[model samples]
Target: MTIKVLVVDDSALIRQLLGEIIRQSPDMQLVGVAQDAYVARDMVNQFAPDVITLDIEMPKVDGLTFLDRLMKARPTPVLMISTLTEAGAEATLRALELGAVDFIAKPKLDVAQGIAEYSQQILDKIRMAATSHVRRARRGESGPPANFVNSGTEKLIAIGASTGGTEAIKEVLRELPANSPAIVITQHMPPGFTTTYAKRLDSICAVSVSEAKDGERVLPGHAYIAPGNLHMHIDKYGADYRISLLDTERVSGHKPSVDVMFNSLAKCAGKNVLAIILTGMGKDGAIGMQAIKAAGGVTLAQDEQSCVVFGMPKEAIRLGAVDSILPLEEISRMALAELNRLGAGTRL
Candidate 1:
């Protein structure tokens, strides 16, 4: 099946670069290229593309506004092309919340030679976006249940996700109470984006959130996100767990790999961990989740119906590593419940 793709950008160079890349792929067809939002809208209505590569900064109408309108009406899978800057990170995250499947940092076009380096990565993102489920804009919901109470177990919660993870992670975090257990997360993002992402979560979530600093103590009621381009793991120091960041080779094809984080928890936190594998595009977390299960830690996975791309969780479930398969909306509630159960049963 050939994927029909539309390229939307204000720059002719970007359109040409992306169009060339798409045309070179045997499995893809360059259906159309639009230089602006108005043209893109017309092209979308005419071609009904299977996927779209959209630039965040555009003339007349910005990418976020266009994306929101598209999702509410047409609902096509989109991959945002974003610059690697703080402002770009913020817009890209908003695009995800509005329903983009994934994003790639725009190649440094000034150094035209560097653009070729991103060709394969851009192709891979398009392929994933072509197959991803495009969810509609969800209505705003209230916070965590008022009756909810944390176990205060001091148990650590580890979460791993990719692809459509940004919004999925936000949904889970928003459901956790202020006193919930400490959480460490890896959400497959480029370097400049995770800082903005952490700050965004901290603003809306009850629990404090920040990008994990090396050797920092992992405390209850706070969430730590692994920095982009680095692998993050927990190390046991005396009686407490501390964050450890490593400039290591890509594990399972990703820096800040979920497997690395999960494996470390299996060794350091042992039964005092509750690990979750969420929506993603690969089998990265399965092996480590299995190790966690073997170490007596509880594991949960997002269910296929709720996942944007049910790859990682499906793999974990296949390995017999997951204790429960749940919807995205239910994960936080369940995590809190499990923490309470573990708290009642064990001290460490």
Candidate 2:
């Protein structure tokens, strides 16, 4: 089936660049091009495009306001186009919270050339959005914080995600108690955005969340996110675990790759680690999750019904790496329960 797409951007250059890109894709049809939210709204209703590429910094009705309104009125899969600045990162994160499927950063210079260079990525995101689950804003509060008994053995929670991970990570972190074990996360994101994402999570979650720095000791009650464009791994130093950032080649087609992080955790923490593969668009974490399982670490995958895109988790389950498949809302609680059982010396 051919995917229909609408381009909504204030810049005429972006409209033309993206329109051409879409028109050139045999599998995608450029339904309409809107210069602002008002025109985008009409085009949306008229064309009923399968995917909408929206810009956040538009005049009159901004993308966020329009997105919020659109999601409430008529939900559709939306991909965001944003600047690579700090403010743009914040707004893009909010757009995801409001229901955008994914985002691509607008280049600061040479817009036309940049968009052309990003053509393949733009096409991939558009295709992913067309098939992804468009989750509406739940407006739900985080469940009660989990309380866990200390097992003396240091525990680690290693999480990996891509496409819809910002919200998924938030959902897991918010549900963790202040005494939860050290958490290391690898979420595929750009350099400037990861810092903002960590800060945003810190503000709302019970656990202290921050961008992981090289050689920092991993501590309980804190969630450390791998910096964008770097691979983060857990290394044991004496009796303590420390975060190690690698300026290495991309594994599984992503820097800060989930597979790298998961494999490291499996090797370093062994059975004491809880590995989770969340919603994403590729098979990045599957082999590493298998390593985790082989090392006796517990593994969990988000089920298809709850995943925005069930790619990574599905791949892990296919490899027989996951011990349990659970919904997004139930993962935190289940992880805590499993941790308790592990602490009590029960087999996972």
**Could you list the CA RMSD of all candidates, in the order they appear?**
1.6, 2.1
Worst 10 residues of 1 by lDDT: 145-154
Please report how far candidate 1 places residue 141 from its true position, in Å.
2.8
CA lDDT of each candidate?
Answer: 0.89, 0.91
Q: How many backbone overlaps does candidate 2 show?
A: 0
> Weakest 10 consecutive residues, lDDT, candidate 2?
107-116
- Candidate 1, residue 100: Cα displacement in angstroms equals 0.5
TM-score of each: 0.96, 0.96
How many pairs of residues collide in each model?
Answer: 0, 0
Could you give candidate 2's per-residue lDDT for residues 237-326 as a string of tens digits? 877899889999999999989999999988988888999889999999999999999999999999999889999999999999999999
Instruction: Quote the lDDT for 176 in model 2.
Output: 93
